[model samples]
Target: MKPRDLFVLVGIIGIVLMMVVPIPTVMLDVLLVINISLALMILLVAMNTTDALQFSIFPSMLLITTLFRLALNVSTTRNILSKGEAGHVVETFGSFVAGDNLVVGFVVFLILVIVQFIVITKGSERVAEVAARFTLDAMPGKQMSIDADLNAGMINEQQARERRKKIENEADFYGAMDGASKFVKGDAIAGIVILIINLIGGLIIGMLFLNKSAAESAALFSKLTIGDGLVSQIPALLISTAAGLIVTRATSEGNLASDITGQILAYPKLLYVVAATVFVLGTFTPIGPTATYPLAIVLVISARRMQTNLSRKQAEEEQMEEEQQIEEVRSPESVISLLQIDPIEFEFGYGLIPLADTQQGGDLLDRIILIRRQCALELGIVVPVIRIRDNIQLKPNEYVIKIKGNTVAGGELLLNHYLAMSPGFDDDSVTGIETTEPAFGLPALWIDEATKERAELASYTVVDPPSVVATHLTEIIKKHSYELLGRQETKALVDNVRESYPALVDELIPSILSIGDIQKVLAKLLREKISVRDMVTILETLADYGTYTKDPDILTEYVRQALSRQITLQYSDRGDSLKVITVGPSLEKKIAEAVQQTEQGSYLALDPSSSQIIYHRLNEQVSKAIQTGQQPVILTSPTIRMYLRQLLERTMQDIPVLSYSELEPSVEIQSMGVVNL
Candidate 1:
């Protein structure tokens, strides 16, 4: 239950209890007892007492009726040696013995208050914790949500699969770590009991020095006053404060935050200080009882102000940090704007001017002697000219770039046909990725989501000589850098992306979990090209190194195909098995030349599952076997999954359409040591 509602319920119960019970002469005493009990319950909850039994009315009832009654009985009987009332003090106790319940009731009420407070706050901190958590999530304090509207079609197979993997991993961690900050123990009742014991014991001790007035002195022994003889026991008060502090901290350790100043918050020393300050100031200064009491109340309540200020400061800093990150995403092109520059006229020489001698002719060129470095991409980049503005150019290629409003126009003239590249921009100068900040936009290169992500990844790597992995990789694959790479280079590129970057490895894991689903997505979007065997390698890599959020079913289908492919290749290539012939491109031809770099004689991106094969050039016999329903593994230029599916579908109609199930499972791994994904 919420704290306020719980308080209201307790209040109503207190009223009913007071009215229901018949207390003619002892009504005031009974009311006070009920009030104490109500306060105890709230104290237990706010202090976060976790024990159900203690919180229930059973403990409260026992304390009020038993402990409170006994304490009150002893407390009301005083040693009245003061004002010559020694004789009167004796008469008061004697009257109490004559069965007068009014005096008896007063003593009971005080006892109940002390006992219940002790029981409730003894060792539980749940009350404090609930209050803290609910308070943090208070209204108008939550961060704005950015629920991205995902486009299934626009994402393509690679992105959706990767994003899902990362999200699922974070969700699992959050569910487990949610309880890390909760308090373990906070017992306010124990501190109260210690105080009560000290109270009762101190009176007994004081009775030795003072005669009939000892009882009065004990009741207010540690209490502050405005005159002499107020506290004859300084040592006793110090001990009581120290004991209360130690006990409170021990009990509240679990629920209370370490950041809280224990000495200031729950430490009993603070209460002692306030009481002492009041007594000393009241006695020395001209302060009245009324003013002194009010000051004490103010000091106690204002203790929490410092903590509030600290929390506010931390929140503000975090918000500022978030805004700074959004602002940092601004693009360089927009930051360096040129007033008037038309790219088209310069590239084609439309606004022609004959050059004196050979002044590079309208194009800026740089002959950069490349440095040998180990990283990723090593492409020639366009460097912008300072102050002169207009016309940004790259090395060797005389190109012109122009920006008029949103349109980006650029053309690099080649020996043959003119090459063209155009991408647009917006007011924020942000290229085109959706961000948490609506105030900022991205640059042109980042306009495409995939490219933007790749650019971020590139910042961490040193792209000098770049990895030789992709130098000759364009010819085999069909996308951006595909035309420039060969088969070997293609495999090398995949290996590097999968293994070198921890983030990339983590991102690929979820996609690999459901191998068949991912393959299908790849096939549909990427032109139907990859084989089941290749998909298996991707899946196995994910299982071994990536974080998989789904069940093992993701592994079954793909593992089967990979194993089947392994068996087929292994059996055909074995020495004793019937002669094997690899039709069309040989294994050497299929593997890219760039990837042939010696890594202990194994293929750079070779799936450990590779088997021996007797390669033969494509011949008429291979075509006849394919037509006659004899299955043979053929190696060729890499094609997208969708295109491969179409080619295989046509082949199935002509042949018997043998299932890949024939391959053996053991051939998948081949005992080669596992490599990092």
Candidate 2:
């Protein structure tokens, strides 16, 4: 039988037994007598409630059974009492336990018990459903947060599951404390004092003034007065000890059985004390075990209050920590910074394109090299390198990496932290993510499949394409003709479409989804027009993906700047010689003069001789270097200009596309120390 059922059964039988047997005059106003049974039933219900408070059919059945049992016992007792004459409840009722009356009353009790048990058995599922609904409906916010974490690759599927469980457990725990507190409220000391006084006075008064002649006195004497004539206090002691055990179990760490074990071991002394106390109460002196029960109830409720508060405090702290993590997504900059790239020599960008006619490498390597060449061409720089596969082979002007999404873990940072914390489960050495570049590992990962599944279940539909596309862009491009298109190409595409056709830009699917629809206007610049002005616009909008856009008018002002510039860098190879030069407006003769002096594997400067070329000031040195396939040199601070320079420099090296939007050209070098060339 369930502990709850046992509690109700014991309580009903004890109450009926009390009424049918006899009430000693002194114990007549025993208002607290019902407490014994009530306390146990609450504790039993509490045990179930404490373990799992989720919506479930069992709790409904359990609750219904408890209420049904109480109703039946109350009705039956009231009816049976009303049936008898004032004095003799069936002198037949007095001796009822031994006779046919006993058999009849007990059979009725058994039938009711069985009927209620069956109802509980049948209604169990509905009860569980109710509990589960209650648990889930109670924690929508926490559930949403868990879902978000799961979707964001902050936590895995299993961890999300465990987090939900923790939320449910906390809800149940505090809820039980509230219910238990209400059930046991009253003045504990007063009840204990009253029980002591009543037992002692009743025993002595019944023994001295009452005779065995009357039915009532005879009944009281038979039930309470032992053979030697002292009051029988065993029943009250049993109730007190049970109450203590139940309270200790609920309020302490030990399980019910453990509490019972401790009680049993301690009872050697308790038994003697109760036996002696029985005599004292019978002699009309008041003090003993019955008094202790009420006080135990008080202490247990108080302790329950304390535990609930502590758990709540812990839960709040955890919530704050989670909030901090979610906020950090402002940029993948942290991940990039941790990869150890120096801010001085290194630069990162977004939405930039590669120069098509630049250095030689496969389609992939070409993309990387072109970005650097573009950056170098735009800013005048002499550094381009690529870190792909596991080695850092030197690319004189370009390089590229082959990345497989399936093999890469999505929550690399989270995984790294987990490994740091747990010594037994630390196997994160296989991720070949790029950390050498300061901008490498820059939160550019796609939302994993695991994240999508979790978010879907939680009803957090994909709000942005990055919510679906960012994680697998690299993989998608590989399969779809989208090889990491040159940073400059991407920038140019955005510039051309956006400039050439704003509506066309709006209609064209974004080349990448990580930076979402919020960047719609910025993307259009690349589709319709290709120019320096459009390039700056693309750079300005790089890291805003996955976030809400707050400014619209400001974006338009920047697009015009990228399209107005008309400076171009040129390169060529003839026989045993390589030629490099810069050109703008009208400088064909200057380009020829510069081109004539260049040799294979050697560098030459392109001095723009025209007035318009000087006005443009596009990095002539960078143009020459990109054309000749040599490292470009740019004299710029660690700011937007520097970032632009770095973008082309690295593309010259071949890694991934870089853009003006990907980085800040801040002159502050505090966060980014110097880097060796």
| TM-scores, all models, native as reference | 0.21, 0.28
What 10-residue stretch in candidate 1 is worst by lDDT?
A: 224-233
Model 2: how far residue 630 lies from native, Å:
7.5
Q: Tell me the deviation in Å of residue 65 in model 1.
A: 28
| Candidate 2 worst ten-residue window by lDDT | 225-234
Top lDDT prediction, candidate number: 2
Question: Residue 536 CA error for candidate 2 (Å)?
Answer: 9.7
Question: In order, what is each prediction's RMSD in angstroms?
Answer: 23.1, 22.9
**Runs with alpha carbons beyond 4 Å of true place in candidate 2:** 1-176, 182-191, 211-401, 404-677
Model 1: CA > 4 A from native:
1-677
Whole-structure CA lDDT of model 1: 0.33
Q: In model 2, how large is the Cα lDDT of residue 133? A: 58
